[model samples]
Target chain A: MKHAFLDEYSGLQSPMHRLDPRAKLVGLVALVVICVSTPPDLYAAFAAYLGLELILVLISRLPWKHVLGRMLIVLPFILVVAVFLPFFNKGGGSYNLGPFTVSAHGLLVLWNVAIKSTVSVLAVILLSSTTPFPELLKGLEKLRVPRLLTTIMSFMYRYIFVLSDELQRMRRARDSRGWSGKWLWQAKVIGHMIAALFLRSYERGERVYAAMLARGYDGGLRTIYLYDFGAVELGFVALVTLFPLAARLLAVG
Target chain B: MHIPDGFLNSGVSIATGVVAAGAVGYGLYKAREELDEKSVPMLALCAAFVFAAQMLNFPVAGGTSGHFLGGILAAVLLGPWLGSLVIALVLLVQCLGFADGGLTALGANVFNMAVIGTILSYYFFYGIKALLPKSRTAFLAATGAVAWLSVMLASGAAAVELAVSGTTPLSVTLPAMLGVHAIIGVGEAVITVLVVGTVLAVRPDLVKTYGYQPPVPRFEEAEVNQ
Candidate 1:
């Protein structure tokens, strides 16, 4: 019913939160590229990137716990990738742990992936925590993101919850009918359920199109609210644009 | 499965970004006629379903869990172009509002999950449906198979991107990604089939491609001989 999992923290206010969505979008992109492009061995650069991100996280006023918790979502995925690096990455320098050998090079690769991914993820969290979904869509559209795709995205964002509710209703109906889905043959029952869902969604699409036509929706879309690039937005963009260039220049120097 | 920013090299990410932008542009041009007023709300609802479905993570093997990608599911119900747009929106929202994905990596994520996953699966599913009976059952089976394959294919493409960027070697990443995702694909297939079937049963008119005539109907009796 209440899906606050997305945009949960977007209502909060801070300097970062006050910036334009497009500004945040561009800034975050610059930060990610800067952090990611640093070589694996550049521990100093990595530390700097982490510090920069930490500052932004604090500036955004999103709770540290929340950011860390969200970052953990990617941990399992990172582990899945990093776990095998010790075994497969053959470079040199082995350290004798208790039961097995840990390669020095493998550890560095792990650090490279783990840290970069975490920082990149944190940057994203900061951006999302500050920006609302509708404005974000509007930002993309204004950024020259194709309208077709944006329109599609806008609808999906709007209806994903509705579909979820539909699914729950279907599941409930089945359960009430004593459909436990415990046995292998019960799999067929699930199959039938799937078929039924498809049919419903299909029919809904046609009706939805008909409704659109009734509203005089022609092929072209004209938006009522035009996004203006304000001074604050410009300043935010300039600040973000400088960070990556500064980071790269510092690295080279 | 959306790879965030800094996951891949700038060259690769930018290249994929350009590709993603072009595909979306082409998709917009193609779907211009279909994106009229009536389709807007339905498209929105479909996007919401995908977003919700993604939140519910079903368990996979080895104590690992996977969520539905919903590309094929969206395509099967909304047609490929609209489906891809829906998924792209979901990803965009996740990045900007939910912070589920990276900002710079938005292009690559759209390419992997939205474009490749939806278009490829829809075409393949559509192709399969052409060979089978025009009944709902045939559509269900074909949708299931294509949905499964699409997930696997997206994973394969991701693995390639990682490998190309030298993030991880192909030998190590390929089998690990494929093996895990192959299992994940089963969940995808099941979800796709179940959702498609349910929609078909309740409101058959919602499916954009429903009642679409195949090159030749497989079963004579199944045909509505007016």
Candidate 2:
């Protein structure tokens, strides 16, 4: 019932956390662009990006353990793609390790991916850990993000748990019925289960829409509360834009 | 499959951002007729649910675990326009609040994960439903296949973005992305089938596609007789 998975650390108090959501949003975007645009061989530029991120991470006051833990989630996917680079990359000199050969070019490719992805992931973890979800959505809206997308997202975030709970209940019921899907024939049972879920979801959508109609909803959504962009927000934006530009200049220098 | 910032070039990021914004705007216009006061709360709750479900990683092979993209799941429950909008919103919040995706790269993330993933998945699933037996069983199978294909397709799109931007050579990037993601699609398909199946059993009334059917009438006489 109480799931704070998405914004677990958003409520923390820190300079980075105190900035307006819009500011953080803009600043991080700029930072990511700068980081991504750095040529793959620009080891110096990557280091600068890492340093900038580290300072921000510390400023946010998020637990190192938390950020690292969240990042670990993507490591497997990163590795799966980059793991064989050394064997397959044809550009560099090859080294024979018994049956397998490793290429210098492949090693570079692996490093390029691992480093960029890790740093980028850390930057995101820091942002999410610091900003609350509702405020974040508001920030996007204020920045002129489309209302329809936000509305849909807000609903998905809200009800995904309800659906998941429904799923758990069904799984429990199946288990109670001695439905152990270990054999090939049992796969059909799973298929039936899937069909049943689709029907239920379809029905729920209708009820939800009907409920919306009952609430005097006749299109055009307007909110009573409007977010004001304050000095803190402006400063935050300046800092975000400035940091990346500075990083780029330093890399070029 | 949300690529973080710094993964692709600035041009790609900005271009994708504009495209993402355009799609979201279009989606909002289309869903304008749909979002009333009742649907508002449901939309918010579904977004929260998507966030939660993404946290629980199911194990893939070789000690790896992957999270659900939820595009198909969302589309199956909500129609495509609404579903795509919801996913775009989630990605927007993810980039800003959670920083799960890049802020600058937000546009690209949305274009791939939200627009491409949700819209494409929805139409594909809908197409399959049309071609198949329209039986509940056929819908389930179609959902599974569509969901799987959508994930791979989304990944392929991302691969193309990276290639065009020249961030990574297409030769290395495209094959690498498609290879791993094709396997990831299996995970997406299984989770989608399992979750979709569960919802079908208990709350058949809740599903949007079933709205055409009249509600099951409660027999007052049976209760009184009992």
> Against the unseen true structure, what C-alpha lDDT does each candidate score?
0.72, 0.69
User: Which parts of model 1 are misplaced by more than 4 Å?
Assistant: A162-234, B57-66, B130-137, B202-226
Model 2 agreement with the true structure over B97-198: per-residue lDDT tens digits: 454665656788888877788887788887778898867788779888988898888888888886676445678778878888787788778877777766
Runs of candidate 2 exceeding 4 Å displacement: A1-4, A92-108, A147-236, B53-68, B96-98, B126-128, B132-134, B167-226
Give per-residue CA lDDT, model 2, range A204-250, as digits (tens): 66587777778776644565434456887787677666766676677
Over the full model, what C-alpha lDDT does candidate 1 score relative to the true structure?
0.72
What does candidate 2 score on TM?
A: 0.75
Candidate 2's displacement at residue B74, Å, is: 3.1
Q: TM-score of chain B only, all predictions? A: 0.86, 0.89
